[model samples]
Target chain A: MTATRRTTDTLVIVIVMLLVWQALHQVAGSTALPAPLPTMIYLMHAVASPRFAENTTTTALELAYALVLAYAIGLAIGVWMGAHRLSGVVGEPILVALYSLPKITLYPVVLLIFGLGISGKVAFGALHGILPVALLTMGAIRAIPPVYLRSARSLRLSPWQTIATVLLPATLPEIFTGLRIGFTVTLLGVLLGEMFASKSGLGFLIINDMSLAQSEDMVTVAIILFAFAAIANALLLWIEHKLHRRV
Target chain B: MTRVGAIRFAVIVGMIGALELACRLGLINHQTIIPPSEMASTLVTLLASGSLNADIARTLGEVMLVIGLSVVLGFAFGLVIHALPRVREALDPFFATYYAVPIFIFYPVLIAIFGLSAIPIVLIGVATAIVAMIIATLNGLDRVPPVLAKVARVHRLSPVTTALTLQLPAAAPYLFTGVKLSVSYGFIAVIAAEFILSPTGLGRDIADAYADFNNRRMYALILFLLIVATVVNGVLHALDMRWAERRSGGRS
Candidate 1:
């Protein structure tokens, strides 16, 4: 579709959805679901509020810290396991098992170990992301074509030289795929931590509003969170697309 | 066992033994880290009490329902989206971006509407899973070889007949991938929703254990969940490999 056509379609869909929302609210006649106009206005107010700002910053900071830890540790482990036959054999099954299992099961354990704080959230987020990153990175490295290896060997490239000039470039796409998933899972982990137990953050705000039956406030926070996730995903996707094009 | 399998088994055993030893030696707090031995005993106790059985049945039922509904709905939605190129193009970015968000945040709204029942839990699971299935189905459709379409044209097959006979079978592998993801991720979302806010199921048991400060039960439940997830994933993976082999054989 043309860009303009696509934009028009999206606009039409959004308008129709808003109309449906309003219709439902009117039909239900429930205070639980305020009208869309009011909800959007309330969302704007929530966004403009200093409290929401603080919460957004807090959640973003926690996510950043956790992603950094997850990326660094996961990358290192993936590289080591991928390159070494012994390590790969010993670690691949365990890592894959961990990756498949839901990491939310460990939230309470994290809370116990780290306590209910940003540290606990960060720990959970990192745990959530680390396995996927490590697994994907390992897979990417292991998938390097045998011909590439043979050529590298014939060229007599050192380990560092081979990694930098060949392996890194070859695996960049897969690595980015892993990173993208890692980033999203990290956000989920932090949100889980906040919801389960936390002093502050978007998760906490949403949960708190829900408990208090602040329907408008709850919806507003939810929208804000969705917007944040959407933006972050788009940004990462754009970067990945650029990298893929370059390669 | 294969050499790699044996090595991996040893690595797991070594880690468990190390953890047990650490707990026994008081290096690791038992309250925080319930050793595998204790967790096993707790699991046995729960089994004897029949609570574990009940929880397992409830959770399994909810997860199955969610996965079944999502798979059907998502595939249908995917087919419609694929048929309508304009709609697919328009909504592609939204779907892609939506996948990244933790849709669990919507559980509250679900609760308000469904009012603390299995409905909310199932809805949450389906919502989380359906998108992945839709994406996978679309991807599968896209992968149907152009030659198949040409062959269908040569046969003068109706579009519906062509899609049903030629395209869907060719896309089965990708569709199965979506099913696998939906099942696994749906399981996760359901359990998480239960854990977060629900009255029954394995999640409730875990949350109750947390409330009671029973580390053993908590660890036991987590361990059981891990085993279940691994088994489910393993089964799906085996089926996927078998399907690939059969599909290749059929082609040959």
Candidate 2:
């Protein structure tokens, strides 16, 4: 559990992964599955290219838009349902059902409604994100100790002041967990949308490379995405741990 | 049904009716979304005709295969890793970050390696689902009371017997949770892989229907998938809740 041991373990895992990659490349051939070293080199080149920058920016913009929509709508619904007991009773199961359902099945419907554009991708990504954010946020609010609200009332705080001082701080940690999960799923949703139908973005590039038999480029892009996701999750988890400790 | 259950049912029916009415009134475009009734009727006809029997069987079979493989293999891995404290500690971060990655992006690469067959689909599904089971197994094993081990020692039970007779039943609830998760994840991953790119399956059928602009067929297929997913998940969730309640009741 020590930092040094953890670091060493991580290094070992990385080496093991590289070995597996190399073994697969050997078995599958370089044309099908490029070696890790070559893929890393290709990744460096790909990252520097104009095409990479453009596609990354497009994906980033779509992700940003989707996150904004997800957070706004999710928080609104969560707060409402969490505060209103009747609505929560009526709506919670429905939301849970929708959340469990394979939402990818509905992507075509999203495409039909939003059309084959950035809007469709953004909407699909937001759709994946909204459920988790809303569910967790609602749980967070409902979990707030009754004493907190009573204390706020005793202080004669206004509704706005009560929410700001008591409710917000009480719920922030759990709500942030929701946001972290939402961030992950939204990225997935956006990638899926692009993979299925899109002219640009990292997902499109991946599919494009596959069709063109650009094995190295494809592997590079996948690795880049893998690294990005892993690093972001680590950062978020660190913050989450800190938040939990604070509370 | 209870009052809340009745109200929930009514709310769902009301929403479906509203959609049907909107379609009937031309308020919503039929091209974008068919009426719920029409989707149901089409699905019934689709089923009666048996045109999609093969696709349904294939997809469901793959899903079953995925669930079975993931649960067994994941539990095995979990057992091995749990016994190895150092390895488990190392793997904690990987497990935490696993689901955060868009794993489906590698489907194409898998296709390239495996030559665009069911192998890739099954592999991806297992990759997506197995982690949940492993984590669940770890959690379940962790929660098995230390006293259970002491009792096993007192009884002079072998390690295998202890695992089978004591650990398994105690951990059944959490293991079931893992199964529930694995089922959902397996279902989603398989369908998504098929949808993205595959020779044949429900996902492929939907994709093809969309491409051919067969809105009726597409909507029916989509509806079928949603219904199946919802029902399966509902059943698992209900079972999970029942087990959870029993566990709590026993504790109290």
Candidate 3:
């Protein structure tokens, strides 16, 4: 797979996929499988909408708040659970149960509790977001060998002192994995909540377009989401890489 | 057994019981924080009325279809990539990029392609699953040390034979891990897609409950959702443990 061959391979896959789409559209009709050209057209129309910008910003703001809050809460719990076996036992299963559950199923309850506002999105996002970080953190902390802790204890280090000097430094790399997973999930939570129930947000905009049969606008909003995800992931990856390199 | 597990179960149940009693005793707003007793009644009604059953069945059908297709296609795709070393290297970055790109972003695209239907819901589920499966397979390939590959070459082992014997078994741990990961993510992806894009199923039922402000019913549904999560997780965990034992040379 040289660059040229890679390009050809990609092109072939795309062409074949598009051909299949075209065939499906021809057979099933536009109501079901609207061809690529129409989708692209709809996306172009959607990008030109003033409301799209505002909605996208609203979603991003909610997502940011959720991610930050989840990071803080999950990191604290995760570190504690990781450092202590008792806490891990009491907490880890709960975290997993929460994470494994169809979080969207909680959307109704969240909506009732938080109302349909940015706060609701943030709250729901955090609920969906925190478990991964907490689990990951607990795991990383647990992975640190007991010998290091014993050595610190032998040196008569205080609990806090051991955590600060030994565990913290040793587990920083693994802890970052929790952060990365937590952030990605926070975004997903925000997006899903917004899409399902919101007055403003990129997800809401997409849903709105769909209802109005504005396929192009729906496509555009989708594209914006794609761009947002790309930027967010790249940023997280860079941060993770930087931290790893520094340590 | 783990004393830790026993204690945790007690603690969790105690918390639930405490919360239920407090709400019942008016230590909290019973309406806002419905007691488990009331929630359980609501649950009975929902199940009796066939709403939960229908919703779960509908959602499960779509998810199962997606999982079935993805497993088959994913394994095939993995095999193809393994067969073509250069192609695997070339596709690696693209796979990583797509994997990092959250599948929720594609919800709108799904709707555009399939409308508010189960097809889009299932397609996105499969898509979310694909990257993880591929990664697991690729990771399995890494278990074949370079030395082993060289030896295999010297001994003239067919690529197919080498793959069936060495690569897959070596990859079993990772593949199982990937399965666990994919199922969980796939669960969320399907529900989220349906919640956002489709007009039916569990997500819709939950959303409708919110819109209607039926708190008791909502609480009931959430409890059931929690049950589903716990059961699925337990199953996955048991499977992982079994595989781990077998993989560790039958230490169990």
Candidate 4:
């Protein structure tokens, strides 16, 4: 499809979504769900508030910490397992099972260990992110063509050189995909941690508004999160596509 | 068992044994986490007591309902979309970014509209799961080879007959993938919804136990859920592998 057509289609979807929101608001009543226009207006003011800044900063910092830990640890595990065949064979299924399991059940244990603080949220977010990164990075390494490694060996390249030249570029696209997914899930994990227990952050703000019957504020936060996730994903996806094309 | 399987079992056992030793030796705090053995025993006792039967039943029933609704509705929507190229093109971006958006954030909005009831929980579950099914359905339909259509035309078969006999069988593997994803997503969403806020269910019971500092009960419930998720996933995975093998074997 042409770029213009795609843009128009996206615009149409946005309009349709707004229309649906309005119709649902009508049906559900203003108390339950404020109309889209007013919610958007509320969101603008809310974003300008100091409380929003504080909570958003808290969530962003947690996400950043979690992403760094997740990437570092996950890449280490992935490289070790991927390079060692036996470990990969034994560990892959275990990782897959962990990935599939609903990890929210373990949040209580996380809470107990880390306490009701930012560390707990960061740990939980990292827990959500680590598996996907490790799994994908492992797959990427395993997929490296044997001939490339053989050539690297034949050239007498040192271990560092082999990884820098042959290993990195070959796996960059897939690793980037892993990072993208890791970012998405880690954000979710942080938000969920906040919603369940934390005293601040967008998730907590949503819950607080819910309890206070502040429908517009709650909707506004959800919309902001939705928009943030959508835009971030689109940007990452575009970069991923470019990387794939280069490869 | 194969060598890898045996080694995998050993590794898992060793890890659990190490954790058990740590818990027993006070290297780990008992207040924070109970030993695995204690968790198992507590779970067995809890099951025998029948105290959690209602909650278990309620949670499982909601999951099943969510799965049924998502699969049926998602497949129907997928079929409609696949039949319309324009609509599919328009929806492509939405599908791509759907899971990234943390649909659970809307759970509160759902609760507000539907009230704090099963409706919101089920809706959230379906919302999380249905997209996977729809994407899988689209993939399955797209892979139905042109030769199948040609064969149907040559044989003068009805559209429904062609769909049932040729398209359905051809698309079965992809459809099964959809079911697998839907099941996992459904389980996660429903439990998470209940965990966040619900009147009653396994998730709620676990939350309540945590709030009351009932470590044993919380650990037992957690173990139960982990076991259930693993077993269900293992069975589905095995079936998927068998189907994959059969397909490759037949081709060879």
Q: Whole-model Cα lDDT per candidate?
A: 0.87, 0.93, 0.76, 0.93
DockQ values, each candidate:
0.61, 0.84, 0.49, 0.86
lDDT of 3 by residue, A1-247 (tens): 3778877866776687679767866865665446679877776766677776678678778988898889899988997887678888777777777777778877766776687789989998888778988888888889888899899989999989998999887788778878877777787788777777688887777677677766556655666677667777778778878877876
For model 2 chain A, the run of ten residues with the poorest summed lDDT: A37-46
Instruction: Return the TM-score for each candidate structure.
Output: 0.92, 0.98, 0.84, 0.98
Whole-model alpha-carbon lDDT for candidate 4: 0.93
Interface RMSD, one decimal, each candidate = 1.6, 0.8, 2.8, 0.7
Docking class of 2: high
Chain B TM-score of every predicted model: 0.91, 0.95, 0.84, 0.95
Candidate 3 has an interface RMSD (Å) of 2.8
* Superposition TM-score, candidate 3 onto the true structure: 0.84
lDDT by residue (tens digit), candidate 2, B187-251: 99999999989999999999999999899999999999999999999999899888888879978
If ranked by lDDT, best first, what sequence of candidates would result?
4, 2, 1, 3
lDDT of 4 by residue, A120-197 (tens): 999999999999999999999999999999999999999999989889999999999999999999999999899897
Q: What global local distance difference test value does model 3 have?
A: 0.76
Instruction: List candidate 3 segments past 4 Å from native.
Output: A1-50, A145-167, B48-52, B144-170, B250-252
For residues B113-190, write the lDDT of model 1, one tens digit per residue.
567889889999999999989999999999988899899999999977887898778898999999999998899999
Q: Residue A102 deviation, candidate 4, in Å?
A: 0.3
**Residue-wise C-alpha lDDT for candidate 4, range B82-121, written one tens digit per residue:** 8799999989989999999999999999999999999999
lDDT of 2 by residue, A18-124 (tens): 99999999999989999999888888788999999999999999999999999999999999989998888899999999998888889999999999999999999
For model 1, the interface Cα RMSD in angstroms equals: 1.6
- The true-versus-predicted C-alpha distance at residue A217 of model 2, in Å, is 0.8
